[model samples]
Target: MNQHRKPRAQSAFTQRAVRVGLFAAGAAGIAGAVPAQAATGLPQHSAIAVDQTFSRADFVHHTQARDSFTVRQFGTVNAATARNQANAVGVGCSVDDHCRSVALSFQIVTMAGEHTHLNAINRGDAVNEHCDGCQTLAGAYQFVVSTPRPFTLDKGSQQKLADIHRRLDALTRSTLPATDLKTRADALAAEVNKVLADAVAKAPKGAERPTVTLHRHLDGWPAH
Candidate 1:
């Protein structure tokens, strides 16, 4: 079966939208406890939750306890885009032996300039949509590689990881003066698509088969 591949720019919306499915990779091993200073902060209640239609693995992301931003960290997502990515090549952190537990959490402070909603099915139907300002980001980005256990990516897939990571790290937060619902939703919306893309790219394709689908509710799911 020939699955149509989308252009890089075209996947923007789809990329961000599919984030809901990312939790499916829960079986993959993860890393360890990070310093309070390393986590990315935003605002929200409960860890991220999956729509349940995405996959079988139940993964949730929590907020609240996090490291205060102080001192420079290495290989972090740039503050510019309000995005972050972690690469744990081959060795899954959560599934790996002796690997400590790490956290993956963030809040959608702003929507891409595209039209979207707080609870959007796709970037287009968002209650607050604004594609023009999709790149205008204004928020925080956080991802920490705990001590002892670090984040890695599949060697062959490292490049794919970097591609997605760069897109995530380069997200521009929403503007301050434009305190509007559409603008905020638009910015946050893009990220949703990005997450989906990540899940699609990471999914087990071929005979094993890769799965990709976005249902709803990725808020407050933790990776416990």
Candidate 2:
């Protein structure tokens, strides 16, 4: 009985040794067979760049490089254009024969301005949360333009309505005075800066693409 037990013990030991050796060999083979491209610092897809200011003066996309980057920018061009329509409205309203025409310009401008301004703010908000032109996170504005524009306010025919309209109309106009357009512009610039955050991706980190840059140049506005 003792001899039979000894042989069984030796057989079990031999089996354990074979299993350990096989496991070691498999691990070594896997380690040695790793893709050489990954081992030598090469990425799968190339890199592209998109650089531009408020309006894209020049935008270029790049690929394959030692120190390469893809820069994306955002600007409120369409909303701004819609907001600027106020100037045409102002001129048209002033010339129209109807009394309500001229008065309506203020409302139109204010409402449009409010809408446009809101849109800009919304875009910025999207960037902060989503890190892109459109909202990436749960709560974000895809795009918005809220400008303050008043409605038709002509008093001679409708005295009560006109009086009430005047008081409420003030709300539609920008609180910023004529002396402060520049200040307001500065504020907008700052807000824009806040929205446009820089995205840095090393060789393997930034393929997801933080943001996409686009452009629409205004006719009169200076190129940002």
Candidate 3:
């Protein structure tokens, strides 16, 4: 009877150890699914450094808190067919390491001389829509051209942009609102898209449509 009881106790201990090992393995897998920054012992909130350039105009936008960020670009236009370029940069951290990436977007908004005709060129990747570790970032570009003209946006694009703008505008005016970084970033994206869509809609129709292009040098950034 003693020998039998001792064997039973040994078997129970072994089973308990196996169960513990399985639980640890499961916990590790869950951690692996999370962002590296969160897995590593890093502060939940830290200052994020941001910089942006639009059509050769340079600006810096940063936030000490990880809640939100905004960037605005404004410049003067003097040429008949002017080209615009913009890029936004930010740094993201993992558990023990950090990497820098940039978001790039561009569009051409112009008006013909002596004519009320407006023209714009829209490229697909006109904005950065994805940043792995970035909670939220917002940006805008407003150029003080010689004279601005009215432009029409595609029905689909126009409606989408308008919706986004309206939502953002409402949020901006709210006295007290509750939301997260992802929501704010999404609202900001709508504002940017509306600007571009409006430019495309108002773009003058002619055989000599100017060319618009976007050149990006960063990885893991999505086009809008």
Best by TM-score: 3
Candidate 3, residues 107-204: lDDT per residue as tens digits?
22322222222122111111222223322222222221112222333466556645654565455333321134224644465455445545544555
Q: Give one digit per residue, the lDDT tens place, for model 2 in 1-224.
A: 10100010100111112101101010000111111111112212211111111111101211100100111111211122111001100011111221110001111111111112111111110011111111011011111111122122123323542433353334223343222422333333333323332211111122122221221111111101
Q: Order the numbered candidates by TM-score, best leading.
A: 3, 1, 2
Give the C-alpha lDDT of model 2.
0.17
Residue 173 in model 1: lDDT: 24
* Candidates 1 and 2, the one with greater TM-score: 1
* Tens digit per residue, CA lDDT, model 1, 7-34: 1111121223421111211112223322
lDDT (C-alpha, whole model) for all candidates: 0.23, 0.17, 0.26
- For model 3, which pairs clash? 118-204, 119-203, 119-204, 151-202, 152-201, 152-202, 153-201
Pitting candidate 1 against candidate 3, the one with the higher lDDT is 3
Best by lDDT: 3
Q: How far is candidate 1 from the true structure (C-alpha RMSD, Å)?
A: 21.1
Clashing residue pair totals per candidate (backbone < 3 A): 77, 22, 7
Worst 10 residues of 1 by lDDT: 122-131
Off by over 4 Å in 3: 1-108, 113-157, 162-224
C-alpha root-mean-square deviation, candidate 2: 32.5
